[model samples]
Target: MKQRPAVDLSELPTFGHGPRTPTWWGTLAFMALEGMGFAIAAGSYLYLAYLTPQRPLSAPTPNHWPGTIVTLLLLASLVPNHILKRHAEACEMLPVRIGLVVMSLLGIAPLVVRWFEFPALNIYWDTNAYGSMLWVMLGLHTAHLITDVGDTLVLTALMFTRHANSGRRFADVGDNVFYWDFVVVTWIPIYLLIYWMPRLD
Candidate 1:
């Protein structure tokens, strides 16, 4: 004879807001780990720079213009990203679609500027510790930028289809917006580290 334990399970709602869903927890976990990665990379940069008291680890003072432009573009993107987040929260399909298109453009613009940033560093990855750190930091952030942009493009296409009507898709959109904010926030200190630190001499 087998005994079964009975429990009531009928009252839970099938669909809930973004924060109530497992996907939101997954997204938060991902951001926390990624943020830790950025922190470690930044700390490494500081440690290496601290050791070099002479002439900035054999690299010239990098041009600040390209990184500055990218930072500005990233900051500018926050406006539309917040708008997108608000629309997603409201479950407004049309606005979400429009916001996706706008965000896709915003994501692409920074990526284009990011190319110029590498050259403006005035150093190569193989040079020395300073160069290597700068390249690694820039490369790490650039990879995130490309990844999130690709995701935005794909989600933009999805929103134009019948899938846009689904509530989960809207939560996904909110998560994307949340991730983009992280991407932008991480760049500020990195930009300063890569561009302005050498000039302190």
Candidate 2:
């Protein structure tokens, strides 16, 4: 009589990046929830605009310069972001470290510009519904931007320490890159709704 030998799991990797990881799925769920929130906010803005056919915003058209700058910066960051993802996926420690630092700088740049963006909206949050919605949209994205930047900074710091070599760390970097892309993508429609919608009149 022959008996089947037990399977050995010891040789299998304990962690993985991308879809092979729980972190990846968690990131996807987080993005989906955040996306829903953004959709709801944008829907509200559209509803208000529909109610006011003559002048959707009923406020001065916002200065598009600050937002446009932010848009361009976020778009530009995609280049470095893809580079970082490549390094992370390859588990190339040196380039991942450098990429983290570069990404940290890129993350902060738009936040600094966003300081001016709030004012460039040409209305206060408390002024009225239109202004309130505008701020809500921007505020939502800003919150995400700040959170992701902090995550990047922390990860950058971690990559300089002993833990930098862990395979899980590379996965974390991939997640960070994924979230950063989400932050950038969500802002586009919000930017248009807040700035251009007012000018439609």
Candidate 3:
């Protein structure tokens, strides 16, 4: 058997921030698939609207207030989200922990607002296809929001433990930040679709 040339493995980093690591790519892949789901859902809504232009067979235009509040809150979340991202990238444990706590709270605030959003829709899931689509879109985004919040809370707890010093955990925080941005960005269009689309008619 021929021997391969010697190579040093000691300097290889076990964790990296941002897209340099596998987890970041995995996070991106997840976001891409979820984004596709949103695209398809939005397309279906538009198609239904197109078919019923004269009277969109849907409920009356929903109250835009709650959705508007949630959108503003989501947009506001970006500030802390990016701050957390910066701390995570720098592998700074103190700021990272603080950011995690802030993020956890941020996650919960929108969820609270989300409860009001369903009622603001002024439609029930079983009412008709329009109602069903509306609920489906909201439910899908809420599921993602809940999931990310849960993840953030868990990570926050873990950061308080002895494992806080791990570089991998910082990378995990970075990934969480990345995912939350996706969660927030995806909501903008859905909010418009659910609340504003009916007004255009």
Candidate number achieving the greatest lDDT relative to the actual structure: 2
User: How far is each candidate from the true structure, as Cα RMSD in Å?
Assistant: 2.9, 1.4, 1.6
Query: What are the per-residue Cα lDDT tens digits for candidate 2 across 116-198?
Result: 99999888999989888889999999999999999999999999999886789999999999999999999999988887877
TM-score of each: 0.91, 0.95, 0.95
Task: Please give, for residues 137-173, the per-residue lDDT of candidate 1 as tens digits.
Answer: 9999999999899999999999998887787888889
Task: Give the 10-residue window scoring lowest on summed lDDT in candidate 2.
Answer: 52-61
| Candidate 1 weakest ten by summed lDDT | 12-21
**Number of the top TM-score candidate:** 2
Which segments of candidate 1 are over 4 A away from where they belong?
1-13
Q: What TM-score does candidate 2 reach? A: 0.95
lDDT of 3 at 19: 77
For candidate 3, give the lDDT.
0.90
Model 1 C-alpha lDDT versus the unseen true structure: 0.88
**Superposition error at 56 for model 3 (Å):** 4.5
Q: Considering TM-score, which of the candidate structures 2 and 3 is the better prediction for this target? A: 2
For each candidate in the order shown, give its overall lDDT on alpha carbons: 0.88, 0.92, 0.90
Number of clashing residue pairs, candidate 1: 0
Tens-digit lDDT string for candidate 3 (135-173): 999999999999999999999999999988788999999
33 in model 1: Cα distance from truth in Å? 1.1
